[model samples]
Target: MPATPPDDPRPWSIFLIFLRLGLTSFGGPVAHLGYFRQEFVSRRRWLSEAAYAELIAIAQFMPGAASSKVGMAIGLSQAGYRGALAACLGFTLPSALLLMAFALGLAGQGDALASGALHGLKIVAAAIVAQAVWGMARSLCPDTPRRVLMLGAAAVALLVPGAVGQLAAILGAGLVGVVVLDTKAQTQAEALPVAISRRAGALWLVLFALLMVGLPLLAHVADSPLLSLFEVFYRTGALVFGGGHVMLPLLQAELVPDGWLSNDLFLAGYGATQAVPGPLFTFAAFLGTAIAGVLGGLLCLVAIFAPSFLLLVGVLPFWVRLRTRAHLQAALAGVNAGVVGLLLATLYQPVGTSAVGSLLDLVLVLLALVMLMAGKLPPWLVVVTGALIGWLVL
Candidate 1:
């Protein structure tokens, strides 16, 4: 059903495309997923709908930044590891550059006007995620069983709270799915083939595990800033569940007490981050630059994102084969439902609460959502508008 030819898009092409995507793509991971769909599936036709959906399935099932994992999977499926790096780097570069500039004294702790604009940016984030929730619910939670599963998952997420709650909700939903959903439904005729082999995937997984465990111990004993930086960011990337704004607290806790960076500088960088496009993980660039300059920023970037890609590479070869099984498919069904619920819970708590404090804020959220769903304005344009409104009103 796709319009493109069979051959893979050139790796350089993938980089250039993602580079542009990185520069302009705003909002957080959920919105990033939506943006990815626009660029890769709808506009570029880099992947078919089913292919994109399956890739999302895998990315959600893995740990780390969901959007980053999805981007890496796209590259891995298309043109091996090089494509993977290219996509990640391209998507990450703009924010990294801006955040690093902030660290280097080129930017400021934004004034009140800037703060209001950032608040507006936050509202745009909420709107983007709301749209994501609606679309994902329609596509991924279509059936009653899955819909029920999603609601249940959301309740559990709200009740339990935190990373542990999120992981449990997803895992439990997978188990529940195995019992209820139909696994024998037909799959797409042509699933995208991954370039990684099972053995290679396993090797990468082993390396990832080794580093996760080893880096912390080394940081504690060796007294190396590099090791500490790697360990702190790596651990946060590995352990955090939702993987967007939620990372902020965990990151602040890790670096602030140690005096690696000051609280004012850290908060300033975070505010500035709202104006830039790409993953929230690029906050690492700011931290890295504050601690050790541009190279530090780049190193932190690698340390933070590496685990997600490694896990994806490690799991895919095996996941593809196993998910085809009826039981596994059923479990995946539950997991998908649970993820939807988790997103809903997130919307209410962090996304909704943080952004919509007053009547004006609520109006902005509604307007942004309508603009997005009406399909006339692109997301970036809506985001810019929201920022302007925030500056003028909030």
Candidate 2:
């Protein structure tokens, strides 16, 4: 592993900072990036802006919760592996605990106010995703070729309509980029703070692969419900590309069919996830609690997040060295455009169709969009206001 950066802070301090973010950071992954930029880059000065943006790039290119992985990267750079752990725990636990408590309280209950709040939260998701789609499209799909790729990806995602479709869209876009995009331009780059040894990075990667392959086999051989649960969540965490919002369809496919949870509960938990302040993956905690209990919640939380931790540790050491490659850049460009498309498709389906049941809900979504885009309101406030409105009107 690499030596800790000279300016490394105490792991406890890192934990506290992330914990505060966990309590207050309310928007989805895209918004989390802004929160991170404000906290680490502008305020804390943990790393240079370029270094921070580099970390964001790594997180975006990877297959997990982008903001969570970026946080992990930041922590890892500051105080080595332990700092990474502290950061993740601090950022994830508050939301996980809140969602778990909500799950336990919500079980077997059918309160209208609660239902209305969830409905409003779902509407908030629609607005948040719409904002993300708009913002990312303006940036990532700026050119004609990229714009075409984005639209094609959206079409594929809508038609295929599942994990298979998503994967196909990403892969196809990447291939197209390899053939069409020119990515030879280079910029002055700063080194990432961490310098974990390639050997150690390899080990972390091997462990990730082992669990990825072995978990399902072990679950199959053991035929244990717990193992099955772990495998399902682990796989989901390992495959989702864009961020937390994009994980929705994959989670639905994995859990709903197995009778692990109902569609209503799933969407409700997702909506509740937005209400809480943290990575969207914390929805796993609610699902696990619904399935079993506190223990199950912990299990799912760890299982779902484990891959992100492993992947970041594995890739961080190599990122600075390999980031300048032309093919890699081209592929990442394609994947990013494809991700925008996936998010666009996602907005209309499970998020929009499920939440906007009437003209009023549609109006609510528009209002929420305006709140986020034009009003400059913090998402947490919007979420709270939405819940109240939903409680009264929905």
- Per-residue CA lDDT of model 2 for 1-394, tens digit only, reads 2332345477998999899998888767777889999988777777788888888878876788888999998888888998899999999999999999989888756565456777777788788778878888897788999988998998998898666887898889888988788886355456888869999999999999999999989999999998899898999899777567667777776777668877667777776776788998998999999898898999999999999999999987777656668887888788778878888887877678888889999999999999989998877688778878887888
- Top candidate, metric TM-score: 2
What lDDT score goes with residue 223 in model 2? 90
User: Which lDDT value does model 2 have at 357?
Assistant: 88
Instruction: Tell me the TM-score of each prediction against the true structure.
Output: 0.70, 0.88
Error of 2 at 299 (Å): 1.7
> Candidate 2 regions off by >4 Å?
1-8, 28-45, 111-115, 185-188
Shift of residue 315 alpha carbon in model 2, Å: 1.4
Q: lDDT (0-100) at residue 232 of candidate 1? A: 85
Model 1 lDDT tens row, 1-394: 4567344577898888889889878766777899999978887777889888888877766657788888888887677898898889888998899889867763345354446666777788788667767877897788999999999988987898665677678788889999988868434334566767779989999999999889978898999888788888887787544445545545655677578875545654565565678888888888888788888888898888988988989988777565657786677667767777887887786667777889988998999889888864766678678878877877
Residue-pair clashes per prediction, in order, are 0, 0
Question: Against the correct fold, how does model 1 do in TM-score?
Answer: 0.70
